[model samples]
Target chain A: MKLLEEGIPLAELSIERIARTAGVGKAAIYRRWSGKEELFVDVVRSAEPADPELPGTSMRADLVVLLETQRQRGVFSRQSVILHNVHAQMKSSPKIWAAYQNTVIAPRRRLGLEVLRRGQSNGELRDDVDIELLYDLFVGPMLVRSVLRPDGDLPDGLAERIVDTLLEGLRPVSSRPG
Target chain B: MKLLEEGIPLAELSIERIARTAGVGKAAIYRRWSGKEELFVDVVRSAEPADPELPGTSMRADLVVLLETQRQRGVFSRQSVILHNVHAQMKSSPKIWAAYQNTVIAPRRRLGLEVLRRGQSNGELRDDVDIELLYDLFVGPMLVRSVLRPDGDLPDGLAERIVDTLLEGLRPVSSRPG
Candidate 1:
């Protein structure tokens, strides 16, 4: 990651070079990670912020915390060159991306599903729609700003704003309550 | 695109090669596009489906059209090897990504904003939030399914489902009206 942060393209990062840089033998690297792709996957997972502890206060709060984690990651990722290189490399190399997806994305998705299930049982979320679809509604916008759009900003309060807006819906109030 | 679809990597694509493949002179390619990046951008734009003409029936209807276009594109892109290569290359090359964003993403964004604004004026949407925020809420979910999540599916009626659910709100109703 330090090498990636310094703009070392993932392609140029050989295990031997990595071991040398770390003052270790190549055997040390091969012992833990079979190859560069596997090593890259581990690096991304390690760098990612741990999943948030749900507040268990309410569905909205839990969702906010989940999104806030993404928000912070987005902010940091933008400031670093590693993500850009890693992301491009991951896409270019399907094996690394698959490993990353199975390890990182799948677990995060399960966490989201758990929260939505809790929301459903507690009467915090509308249960008429498919739960997976509901989860996408909650998580997608923040990700758009956080991951997809390079220019998207993760301003303070964005997580709360997203949750509140989705809960409240975009429908104009029949009459302004205030 | 032919080369890309056949699994030729972008790094190996050169104007001379492209011209040779197309049976055109290098000067002919240069006269049309400033460089390989510009030509690649043109190819992407040309390949992208034409933007949908809004139905002008209601905000819900219009939004469905917009999202449906994305859904179709998503489905097509997943099937095309060209996209996998182009997408990776685009992200790797800042210059190409910038040009693609400016020409493709910018106009798409403007269309989204326009639709959202119209919805607000017609009392179909809440005016309290910033319009851009509102736009993000509507577009973000579909994009997540369409762009960010590689395994996400774009089934029929997904556009309507997203639009309707968003308009209806996710808050549990005080009582089930149905």
Candidate 2:
């Protein structure tokens, strides 16, 4: 992971390097994984966040927490390198791509869906909200920004602002009785 | 552009093939542009939509039109291939990257910002709306979706739905009277 974060090409990730980095024997690494790709997948899978504790509070708070977690994960050192590499290789390396989607993308999407579902069930979100589109709205900007401006910092309170805007859009008209 | 849409790698974009395909001599192409990179940039620049005429009927309509244009430009044959290529090469080919950003990305973003500014002036959106964030909200989903599901079709009325969600969230609360 450190090597990847430092922007090492995926092709350069050798078993010897991993063994040396982790202070393990090459034999130990070989016993558990077939190759660098498999080992890389395992490292990413291990980084998946455990099932998030739902805030069970307001939809705004729940969404804020959810997006904040995503932001933190993305902003972490070297994760962006891993993400960029996987995205670039999605077409050329189906196996690695599948592993990345299954281990990283799918789980995060599922967690987001769960939060949106909770919002809908609690009458905080409009019944018609498209769960998939809503999920994209929640995290798409951060993802795009990360790609376009790798070194740029997001404005403070961006997560809160995204939640506020989305919730404002999602709330039923009748519910906002002033 | 045709060759790129057909998924030719940038390295494979040859002046001889381009000349043959376009029914022109290789000398003719070289006489106009210094090299393939410059020619490719010009081709992309020519494809950019001229300043889009805003309907100004409503924010929702304006946003729908804006996003629809983005979708069309993205979905046009193999523009995605062009986009992916440019993105992948941004680090290695700063000149091409700058040209792409100037010709493709910056113009579209400028158009979006203009529309949002209009909305704010017309009292269709809150003065406090973060224009940059709003811009992302309008197009981020589509961008992310296009990348992730290159072949998956968006549901009908997706443009409308995205606009609806964003407008609902962005309209000033006080403006919506019971």
Candidate 3:
């Protein structure tokens, strides 16, 4: 993981490097994993976001917390670096891509969907709101901003602003008469 | 461009193939551009969205039209294929990366920002709205959805829904009164 964060291409990573970095012998690594890809896949699986404890707060507050946690977990972190490397190599490595998606990407998405579903059940969101689309709207800005300006810091209160905008949009129509 | 859309790797794209595909000799291609990357960059530059005639319409209408146009231009098109290929190769190919960003990404963003600024001046949007952040909020959901489910079709009325949500959020607090 350290070597990956240092931007070493996955194909160039070796058992010798891993063993040396961990102060272990090559035999030790070989005993556990057959090759570099397997070892790296295991490293990524370990970094998956655990199912978060939902705050059970208002939809807006829950979404703010979710986006904030995604930012902390994904942006400017070793996990993010690994995710990028895996994505870049996805076309060539199907097995690793599936593991990455199932472990890293899917879990986060499931958590977001669960939060939206809770909001719907509680009558905070409109009955017609598309939870899938709503989920993307809530997190898309931060994700794109991170990619476009990886070195730049996010503006203050971005999470709150995104949630506020989305909640206002999702309000039941009858509640806001002209 | 046809060859690229057919899934040929850029590095494997040949002048002979292009010439054969276009029913011209390799000499014809070389006369216009030096190499594949330069030729592709030129194709991308030609595809950049022109300065759209803003209808000077309401912010909701303007944004919906803008996003719909972007979807038409970007999703599942030859232009999008070229853009993705260039982005993937960006780190190793700085010149092509710069050309792609300058030609494609920047122009679209400028147009969107212009619309938001117009909204603010006309008092349709809150004066405190962050135009840059607002731009991302409007486009991010569509962009991320396209990436996450490239094979899945967008739901009906997606553009209208996104614009409606954003406008409601951007409406002045004093106007809502609730």
Chain B TM-score, all predictions listed: 0.90, 0.69, 0.68
**TM-score of chain B as predicted in candidate 2:** 0.69
Write candidate 1's Cα lDDT for A1-178 as tens digits.
Answer: 7787778877788998899888999999999988888898989877767778888898888999999999998888787677656776787777888888887889999999999999889998988899889989998999999889878968999999999888887888773332
In model 2, what lDDT does residue B12 have? 73
- Please, what are the lDDT tens digits per residue for candidate 3 over residues A56-109? 767667888877766555553443656666545653466666666665677778
Select the stronger candidate by DockQ from 1 and 3: 1
lDDT of all predictions: 0.86, 0.69, 0.68
TM-score of 1: 0.89
lDDT of 2 at B94: 67
Clashing pairs in 3: none
DockQ, model 1, C-alpha based: 0.57
TM-score of each predicted structure versus truth: 0.89, 0.77, 0.74
Give the per-residue Cα lDDT of candidate 3 at B106.
79
lDDT per residue (tens digit) for residues B1-178 in model 2: 6786787776777889999989999999999988877788777656554446778797667888877766665565245556566545543566776676676678878878887787777766666657788787778887776655555356557778777776665334544535
Q: What lDDT is reached at residue B149 by model 1?
A: 86
Model 2's CAPRI class is acceptable
Candidate number that wins on TM-score, 1 or 3 = 1
lDDT of 3 by residue, B1-178 (tens): 6886687776776778889999999999999988776787776556545435657668667888887765554464433656666545554466766666666667878888987787777766665656787788888877766554444346557788787765564233334546
Q: Model 1: how far is B33 from its true place, Å?
A: 4.2
Docking level of model 3 = acceptable
Ranking under TM-score, best-scoring first? 1, 2, 3
